[model samples]
Target chain A: MSDSKAIFLKDAAVNAADGDQRAFIRKALGGYYVNRDLQKARYRDWERARDAASLAKWSAVNDLAAVLEQFVANFERNGGVVHWARDAAEARDIILKIAADNQAKAIVKSKCMTSEEIHLNDALEKAGYGVVESDLGEFIQQLRGEAPYHFVFPCMHVKREAISELFTKHLGTAPTDSPEELTMIARRHLRQLYVDADIGITGANFLVAETGQISITENEGNARLTAALPRIHVALSGIEKVVRHLDDLSVLLPMLATAGAGQPMTCYNTLYSGPRKEGECDGPEQFHLVLLDNSRTRLLADPEQRDALHCIRCGACLNVCPIFKNIGGLAYGTTYQGPIGSVITPHLRGLKQWNHLSGASSLCGACTDACPVRIDLHHHLLHNRRNAAKEAPTLFDRVFHHGFNFVIKRPWLFAAGGRIFRATLPLLQKLPLPYMGAWMKTRDLPEAPARSFRDQWKNPDA
Target chain B: MPDARSDIFARIREALKVKAPRPHLKGEPVAGKTSAAAKPWLPDGGESAEASLAILAEQLAKLKAMLIRVPDHASAAKAVAELAAAKNWKKVAYHGHPLLRPVAAALPCEAWEADASFEKQRLEGCDAGLTTCESIVAQLGAILVSSASSGGRALSILPHAHVVVAEAAQVVPDLGSALALAKARHGDQMPSMLSFITGPSRTGDIERILVLGAHGPKELYLVLVG
Candidate 1:
């Protein structure tokens, strides 16, 4: 393993064992699972909805070229500008240019995972613009100068007391710890920023090809203000977010809400077709949509693993993942986390450095089951592991596998090896074995039998 | 930009060289005709409009939005006055919808025009904003407001409290019906912004505790007129 990866795993292992963090995650995610189950029960045929949504996404990915063209045409027809970005640098440049052209001094942003993927906030900050995150969770994370703890819940790991401290330190609010009071404090502070900001930046949940509109779903209503009050509005999204029909939201919206937050629908599901229309009083005067292709085509290039692009970023896999619940979101050390993150990060970033993430899972199929788009996420992790091994196999792995294959193929040698292992179990346990010690850190080794099952089969009486 | 677009498309075509043919791209409306067939799996609120309205009310209440049923536009105006008085709002900003003239006239306090020039200073000064909705979703208890009918996105979002006036005829069974209505009304030219609001602005980001009015209206009230 790379030194960085080894250190990351070590840090994650230590963090996973923290009692307070474990308790917080368990309580928070447990409540989420309960609410999700209750909300899902309201649907008569959730599985059918999931299947149809998956099919729609599959069709969109298949006809991506035509669909994207149609979206651009319709968007332009509605007075929206579309910018194609081949990489993160290009995308950043496009946004920076817009900000520079407008002479924008302040910017308000809603929660967008794609923005997190591109590190847009840091880039914009470096350019000397005052960029503020409007989403409450993201606002807290930003104030603490930390990355998001979870995809949906950016500050899920932070406790209320920490938030009270954060507010006191950052906003200079009274030492009020109540959630409602804290929300009001943020609302009062950010409401002014929204009005004064020259630019608003957001992420699109879905891009409708037929109408040339971008759908943004949120409960906090920050996205609405961010899209409405600014003179310039820019939406950054991965090309995979495109959907074939506007009616697709009928199925996709509920699926996303139920899977993401256990709601039938978020409070605000706004579709921006273009900039403010000819007679419109509010909304941005200029609207720009940036379609980013940062190593996504690489995943699309592999037919076998292409379905990984179907992920909706609902984060259900993370909520249900045992490893994530234990080790937490920060452990993955990538933009996306949990099962979907592990499967795609290697491809999105690079395999050699991130290949270790594919090994983080127990290969359980919960992620596949929870996936609304039916991405077969766990199987994708397996594919990543196989590809990683093929790309660069270490000498230790080769030697161990070859030795294991040789002994297992010979019956007599296998039996002899088993006997030897059972006899030396005490010695092995006594010795400070490196690998076995690490394995035994969180688990117990099963006791070896007195004799092999093969031995018994050959001579039962003995 | 053009080069990047073409290059990405070329890569996609190369990657999908041996893929299946896309049937939906052939000018056949896959969702248009088969929407009904796809409707069987969706939740059934009711077959009658009355039943759907009941479900809508129940759902909206669950989301913490106040829903008041009025007999007609006159009563809607009265309800608006009563609500404004209860909230002690002295000044109200209202969208210039012809249907909302009665509510504007009946307002007990000073009413301000929410027009194109309605800037942040005016919105902040106003205690409440009144607007009209295009439709309401019964299944999810969502109010559908478009820039065409609701004045603009800011009217429904920026005020301390947002009050929406809607006719019972505008209620629909689900989001699909809402989309159908928009398609029929505007055809190729849609409003720049179409928002579906379920309740007051809220967040659960701080310790997963529910809090209202994160960055929009702290209070949401629906006055449904028949």
Candidate 2:
């Protein structure tokens, strides 16, 4: 491991342990497992629903992509301008330009990972606009000036005492550790910002092409205000988020619930198309959908890896990763984190810069099994490792793989090498171990067998 | 800007490629994939008057909304007058829906239409707000909010206490039925926002401790008028 990554992993390991990381992780996992099964049954009932009217209403799922295009077309037809961004930088620029055009002084944002990836709030603030994260987890992380740690729960890493300290220091309050009271304090503080925001930015969970609608699913109602209260509302999302029809969303909706929070659905599943109607009382006059590609086009180019595009960012892969449980999202050193991050980061940013992440895994195959749509993550990780070896191998790793390949390809040489390796066990143990030993410090290493089966078979008579 | 125009077209072309029509469709609409095994399910907008009222009550309870069974518009108006007088409320807004006119007239404060320009004023100054419900879902006790003449996005959102007046006839079985009604009412075009409000606005953002009324209404009230 690189020195920087090694240090990050060590620090995260300590923090996760100190914060009862194992118990927390286990709790999340247990919630997901139970919710997954319950949702599975719920989806089956939804699927088996027999009423003709109901069936026709839900057929949108089968035609999701088509529906999304229709939605885009309809939104455009309705004077709601739509912009497509191929990456985070482009998405940021699109939003920044919109804010500039509107001469926005302040922005109130809801729960949008796309905005987080683009660092939209910081970008706007750098341009001298005040940006507020209206979502509760987002608000907490905004105060801390830290990246969000969870998909649904951003400030999961923070304890009540820490928040009490943050509030006491920032808002000038007596240090009190009650979550309920702290929430009330935050509510009071954020209410002013919500009303005062000039622009609002959000992310779409799904875009129904058929109806020209952006669907936002949330338990908290902040997104409603974020879109409605501001003079301008901007929604940023990936290209793959489009479903041909809204009915197709039926199949995908339950999948998202199971994969996301393990609930049947969030409390709010809102769909917004364009600006307010002529007679409407309140809503933004302008709406913008910034469809981002990032490196997704490249991902779509490869059929084997294209399924990565199907990720709803439900974060099931991250929740189930053994590596992530120990080191946490920060150790990954990328916007997207955990097992999915390890696979997609190098691909998005390029293998040359982030090749080491592909080697970080033990290939336990937990991520693939945990994926709701069944993304074969372990195989993809291995493929990434192979590609990294070819595209950007270090001198030492190259030599190791080259030599290892030579021996493994030749059975006779491999058998002799195995014997030699057995003979040098004492010497190998006596010599000071390296980073692998560091890994072994936390985990138990299995002992070598007494003899190779081939050797034992050869000497059977004796 | 280059990414915006080109990428969209590129994605559109790719999508078209996937959905391209084929001769082998055999009237199946695609590359000969069989018709979906079963038809898609849509919501049926069927409910008895009794069931509808029951659903409205249940939804009100779920939202923690105050439910008062008032005899007519006069009594409902009286209740509002009492509330405004009791709380020392400064300003209030009411939707233009026919059902809400009496309540608006009864209130001591002036009422304005749902205008985006007045959102900040309504949000900050309004002590109580009222709107007519487009529909209500029985299963989750959720109220369907749409931007109609009398039902602005802000009516249910901006006020400290949002009072939604529901008729016994407007309740449905679930979200599917509500969405179907929405689609039928608005055509293929979705409104700027359709809030499925189940209860008062709340959040657990600070540290997973539930706090009621973050940026939206701190309190919700449902007036079930027969």
Candidate 3:
């Protein structure tokens, strides 16, 4: 195994045993499930809605180039500029150039996992620009200098008291444990930042091809303020965010909210076509849409795993994933932290380095069932495992599999082997073999029967 | 940049070479076959304008937004005055739309003009904002406000309270119809910003507890006029 993969496994094991993290995940996901169930109940034909959304995404993926061309044309027609980035570094450079050109000193940003994917805040801060995260969850995570704990809820693992402490330390407010007070404190603090910011940065939920509008959905109204209050607006999005029609939001919006937070709809779903129009006074003067490929094309190149690109990022799989619930989002040590993350991270990064993530699953298929786009996630994990094994085979793996196959093929050898294994179970338990010891740490081998079932079947009269 | 775009497109085309070209998708892509095959889901009162208005009121009330129905523009004006008085609002910022002239005229407060040149700092100081919506969505109880007609964006967001002046005819059954209306009205060139404001700004990010007015308006009131 790679050194980073080994470290990741060790860290994941420690995080899985953390009682507080586990409790937080359970409570938060439990509430999420309740809300999802209630909101999903409103739809008489939920499955049909899912299918329609899936088809729309599939169509977009199939004709991505044409759709993106159309999007660029339409957006540019509305006075928006579009840039193409082959990877993260290019995406970051393009953004920095925009900031430098505009002489921006301060930037306000909305919650965008895409921005997280590219480490945009770190780059911006390093360049001497004051950056403020406007989403309440993202702001909390930012104050603590941590990555998001969940896809939808960035600070889900953080308690109110911790947030109160964070605010007291950072914003210099009197410590208060109330969620409402903490939210208000953040709101009051970030309110001025929006007005002072020279630039606003955001991630798009969907890019409409028919109209070339970038749609963003939020509950706190920060995105609206971020886009509206600034002189320049830059939206950084993965090229996968495109949808074919404006009407597609009718299905995508509800599906995303119901799956992510169990709301009928988010409080705000705004579509931005471009910069301020000729007569408009409040929107950004310059609007730029940066389309980042960043290894998404690698995933698209594989026909078997291409459907994984259909992810809407609703994070339903994370909420329902057993492995995710136990190990938590930070355990993965990647920007994305669940089934969809596991499926695509290998392609986005390198497969050999990230193969361990695919092995983390129990293959419960809950993630597949939860997926709105119906990407066969567990099967894809199996495929990833197979690919990993093919890429790097060890001598021990070859020997063990060959020996097992030989014994299974011979009935007499298998019977004798089974009897010997049962008799030596206690001895094996005490053996200091590294692999065996690791397996026995949290589990015990089942007690061996007095006799083998095959032996008893052959000599029942005895 | 052009090289990168072409390279990405070339890779995509190579990957999709094995699949049959779907010629039927040439023109404007048709709405997905799935959406047409199975009847799309709609809320309880998402049938007609009258039924949708009732449902919109109920849904908005559940989201902590007040919905007041009036017989005509004059009554809507009266409702706005009563609401402002009850809330003890002393300063109101109103969108410079002809539809909202009646309410602005009847407001019992120092009214501020929300125009293209209106100062955002002053709008932030107002007690409430009065604006007109492009449409009201019944299923989600959302008010659709576009930058084209709503005196830009800050008028509806920066104030402590937001009061929307909408007409009964502007109510839509669901988000689908709302999008259709927007498309029909604007065609290919959409406004700079179009927002669907469901209620006062809110957040449940802290311990999954819902808190209203995290950043935007603390109160949202809808005055539906004939």
Candidate with top lDDT is 1
Question: Least accurate stretch of 10 residues (summed lDDT) in model 2 chain A?
Answer: A50-59
Name the better of 1 and 2 by lDDT: 1
Model 3's CAPRI class is: medium
DockQ for each model: 0.58, 0.30, 0.53
Each prediction's total of clashing residue pairs, residues at least 3 apart in sequence or on different chains, is 0, 36, 0
- Those runs of model 3 whose alpha carbons end farther than 4 Å from true positions after fitting are A451-462, B20-39, B42-45
Each candidate: fraction of true contacts kept? 0.70, 0.37, 0.63
Lowest lDDT 10-residue stretch of candidate 3 chain B: B20-29
lDDT digits (tens) for residues A169-230 of candidate 3: 88899998889999999988988898889999999999998898999999989999999888
* Of 1 and 3, the candidate ranking higher by lDDT: 1
Candidate 3 lDDT over B123-194, as tens digits, reads 777899899988988988889998976889788888889999888998988787788889999897678899
**What is residue A377's positional error in candidate 1, in angstroms?**
1.0
Span of 10 residues, lowest total lDDT, candidate 3 chain A: A429-438
**lDDT digits (tens) for residues B183-203 of candidate 1:** 889898899999999899888
Q: What's model 1's TM-score?
A: 0.96
- Tens-place lDDT per residue, model 1, A234-253, is 99999989988888888788
